[model samples]
Target chain A: MSKNQTVEQRYLPEIQRKEIDELKTTVKGASQKIIADNIARMKKADSHRPDTMKYFDDIANLFGRRQQEIEAEKQKGKKIIGYLCLFAPTELISAADAIPVRVNSGWYDTSKLGDRVVPVEVCPVIRSTIGAKMIELSPFLEQSDALISVLTCDGMTKLSEILSDQKTIWGMNVPRVKDSTQSLRFWSAEIKHMKTQIETFTGNKITRNSLKEAITTSHRATKAFRRLQELRKGNPVIMGQDAMLVNQAYSWDDKKRWTEKTEALCNELEKRVQQKDWVCSPDTPRVMLTGTPMFWPDSWKLPALVEEGNPKGIIVADEQCSGERILNDPIGVDEWSMDDMLNAISERYLMASTCPCFTSKDGNEDRINWLLNKVKEWNIQGVIYYVLRGCMLYAMEYNRVKKALDKINVPVYYLDTEYTREDVGQLKTRVEAFMELLNARIDF
Target chain B: MSTAKEFWRWHEYRHTMPNIAPVSDDIITAGVDVGSVGSKAAVMVNGQAYSWGITRTGSNSPESAKKALDLALKDTALSTRDLRYIVGTGYGRVNVPMANKAITEIACHARGANYIWGSSVRTVLDVGGQDIKAIKIDATGRVVSFLMNDKCAAGTGRGMEVFADLLQVPIEEIGAMSLKVEAEPEPVSCTCVAFAKTEAIGLLRKGWSKEKVLAAYTRAMAVRMANLINRVGLEPALVITGGQSKNVGIVSRIETLLGVKCLPTPNWRDGGLDPMVAGAFGAALLAKALYEKTQQI
Candidate 1:
């Protein structure tokens, strides 16, 4: 096989090649439609949406203008590094002078194509990621020189192996036991190894100075994100779905630009707060959404329904990895030394994570505490805990989180769903019922 | 040549008390619940259920809502315009053009169950046309926690109707017929209605009687409902509501499975309100509260 040959050209015959060509068109069209429809819904999501939101919304339009921007960046001789899980440190990818793009997709049509490679019961995130890669439809996946595959779950681990057939893969072994000295040391070594692999792949040595700059870049974004969280506390000026879109854009946007735009959005929200221009009435139910990460297109459903009631309930905050958790949990770097920075990054990514991948002695006390704090801070009346079907780790942790919320008298509605739109009606009823419960409680 | 004509059809009816004359100043409220398989409307006067009607939901939801409300208002001096407030519920709640407010059937059922059986009811299991819900409510009929069946049509009124049609038994007779079996048979598949139907066909091939097949299905539905009920947990004075509560086979089996008898559904002041009208009745009760709140404001 030639180095420059495509997967289809090498593996498929002429007839199958033509079939794939037609299928690729369908996949591309459907993916764009999903992105466009979601963006339109998001723009009209609130009547008082800040003008700064358009920037983040455009970046979330996966196959749109963002692709041209990525192509231009590639033309400038910068390597694009695609990643899936948050465990893959984005700062390290930036340190190697490579642009990091989170390539996890939430489109249903592309996930169907993945059935050919993986079983149907595998996680939709894994399926869509691999499915987009197989058809070469995702511009981010196509442009990425290498994918940083973090071993977070069995599905992701297997996904890396399947992706390795067509792409350059750098696999990271995340320690499942998050709260121990031994695991910390093990993770630090793994990060160091990843640093070396990324440096070699980009042919750029990650000096201590470049690594510090990268850490500072993410820290600036985190600063802006923390400010946004502060604004969301008292009265929700921004809806959860819009805030999640901002966080999601951080995965694909240029770090400095994302920080600037987020800071601007936060500024608008601050103004709205002073003007008392709340997105929803004060009596509306303040819901805190947690559980599995919701990516673009598919992320719109639950959050949209959350706010689409007579009084229109508001998602005051969310603890999802794709929402508030992005650019959060910043690294606490004491020394500017390479080893210390690497150790801090490893610790921040591993120990501070509430992602259900790690098993702590207290059974997700960290996640529960994080959720409870959010609930209290926002005065959230309810919690909508939705798990994407086949994402078992989040589903498994629901009962524990529900039990914790029960102690605080906050109601949690557990919804199990996939990427399809088939169950929207059913989900709407449940979500509305939950909103009704919260509203009635507020009336008393 | 099977000549049995639509064994699953259930008659629709409207009833109102002739003794209580219509008072113009009284607070009038209506609740229209347009479910997937059936539609119901309950009219309440000053928080009391005055009249109610049940009908099969047609293709057009707004029409169904109108038809149900018209039936409930039939032979009554009060017209639809006289109602102070109307609350719509169930799956087609949003489509009710005349409703001033639309509340979910979950909240409505808990409220209706409280009104029907009193505030002692803590857990309410409502088996409706397309789904089942196990709701845990407080003394004030406020929903504390509730669980609805997933996006499946098993263990619901619709599933029971399918069984009735398959067995060539009238829908109303299914409960009594299922009880006629001398010994309890093994339940059918408790997973899916489609799979259970296939299993029932297999049982019939094995020469099992229709009564035994009906028993097996009802038992399976009861087991599924019991699982959901246990998941929500059984508090004291559990009340069963909705269309499936009319079927004693499922209700009795669920009682035996949970080892707790459900509270009886008495004829609401001899108005002959069927258990199927719980959602509508509950909505009517809520409408009365809303009307009163507005009046005070």
Candidate 2:
């Protein structure tokens, strides 16, 4: 088998392996329904698809197995509530003993629903968001006890108000505090307010001790994760593409298992880092990520192209929402002042949770400049901006950013991804060309 | 009556006393714009701002328009008979019977914005009493694209008026009140103007200070106005013309958001030059060119 094929085989889960084996035989004779049914069954059995009905059944099974533990907790009489944010500090919320859910809208048919509220000329993100609201397609919308809406974008603000009126809405006004001292104070107050809101919503008071405990646990996990990523940077022990997938799944899967597996992975990664056993492909070109990640499962191909071409060179320095914003934030509960701790957390969340839809041009420019600075620091050869198709805000602003980066002499490539699976090959070709261009520049 | 005639006779005597120059016909083309909030008339006699008239659009827009036109004509001592073409522009432009042609307020405002300021302006943001427009312009004062926020009164002069009434202060004093505020008040978060008024009332009942409330209102207005500016990318020398230009509070907040200073016209008062009239002036200039071309054809 080819190197890429071997890597793919090595990474495939047991269920995916079974499906591949079945697909080889099914392609010769099975009807479309049979094939689909088989795929669906496998997906149902998989614990990774947390939102699937089968995943819920698995949770029920776990509940059944842990009935004594659950009953004892129930007897303790703690109120259970779900909180949603663009990127909520899961560690903080978990510390508060409240379930924190990341609210992301699905990519369904939005043309009809979007037309009802948003103007036709507005960007597609706004349209899709409006469409999601009109059709109520958000997985967490119905289940969420309270929603925390950050002022990340104009569209998000509008959607938050609309959703909040339907349910309990907590407005998180994370300010753009630039000074480190001021930022810490601001983040601390925000966290305190969040704690209060959590208490109000769940009617379960979060004591100082619990908050600190939660913060410590989350801080440890984040530090470990960061260390693992840093290790990858030194030696191509882990493919950058695999790192991205693991990060994406980090928030979506069962936290206990994810943490355990990640710890194991980190241990393995530490050994590799010590041995200096990093993958190296001469053809691979290092590229930094910019812009929003389109909701395609195989959009991972953009980073995969770099790995498949050259194993160790590609590193993602920035991401629109997923990469840094979701992964980098840690609760600042160790500080003496709870307010200061909250402020620090809030500021990081504010700076990190920047969506393209926000009205601050300077903020957006600053983010781009920071990313470029990191690229230079890491010796990255090129930058790739993955723009979502129909996202108007980014589409409109892309040229402006390009002009700004051009002055700095950084080569930038833009790829538009439709969150559909069919565009994988087209995405692969574009990414390949982008990687090649970066490599050519390095030679010169 | 005797004193009035004596004064006129003295003015005539003084005019005759000097080595006076001969009178010229000086055929001038003029444009009149009667808008929802104000009326303005401009006379370009021999390609110059010979004279202009402006007044608040009151109960009778057409009469105010006629008064503005008459004032411009009187300043030059020229009658309607001396004009080759008369054009009207604005929301109330259709009501001006003396106008040979009428144009929309948008085209007129863009022309006016470009005329008063040199045309390096890629975008024009005008906040009138009833409407607000973000216009993109070419080097020659022609509109490339434009966006307006007229569906609601939250970002317009009317919203300010409502807040002024709620505060029991004159609408003109809002700018000064906002300046005195050391701390910004809680933000008015409601989208609807009417709902915001209720929210403001609740705040008052809660004993929040008035200046703080006004400051909050200013911030909210700034946020709404900045949305338009953000839609059109920021270019330097941004000229903010209209009644809202007078509001120091709104202007300061806008500058803070855009990180650019707003340039107001020298004659920001007197409704400045009506954009509708400016557009009509442009149209007349175009017509003159067309007429000259047709004569050649």
Predicted structure with the largest DockQ when compared to the true one: 1
* Steric clash pairs (candidate 1): none
TM-score to true structure, per model: 0.96, 0.45
Top candidate on lDDT is: 1
In the range B1-297, model 2's lDDT, one tens digit per residue, is 343221101000000112222236544666777766666676665444555665666677678668767866663456777766676765566578787655455555666667777777777787776667676666766654445663456767767877877787666678778868776665689746798888889878989777878788788888888887787556666767666776788888889888988765554234344332444445345333333444465
Question: B183-282 in candidate 1: lDDT tens per residue?
Answer: 9998886647788888888999999999999999999889989999898878978988988888889889988999998988776436665678889989
> Which regions of candidate 2 fall more than 4 Å away from where they truly are?
A1-92, A106-142, A176-191, A253-257, A272-282, A294-316, A329-334, A351-366, A389-408, A418-429, B1-297
lDDT of 1 by residue, A366-385 (tens): 88889888888778888989
lDDT of 1 at A369: 88
Residue A420 CA displacement from its true place in model 2, Å:
4.5
> For candidate 2, lDDT tens digit of each residue in A1-444?
566442222211223446434543443232223223433543432223323223222322211322343344445764333333454556566666765555444332443356556556544455554454444444334445666776554555665665553556777765554435665466557667777778776776666676666666666667756766566544355555445545654444445555566677777666656766554543356667778653313244455444543112466455556555556656544474655555555665655554555445334455565566666665566777767665666666677767766777776666666534455533443454345345435641
What does fnat come to for each candidate? 0.78, 0.00
At residue B237, candidate 2 shows an lDDT of 68
Candidate models: Cα lDDT each: 0.86, 0.57
Identify the candidate with maximal TM-score.
1
Off by over 4 Å in 1: A1-15, A362-364, B1-4, B267-270
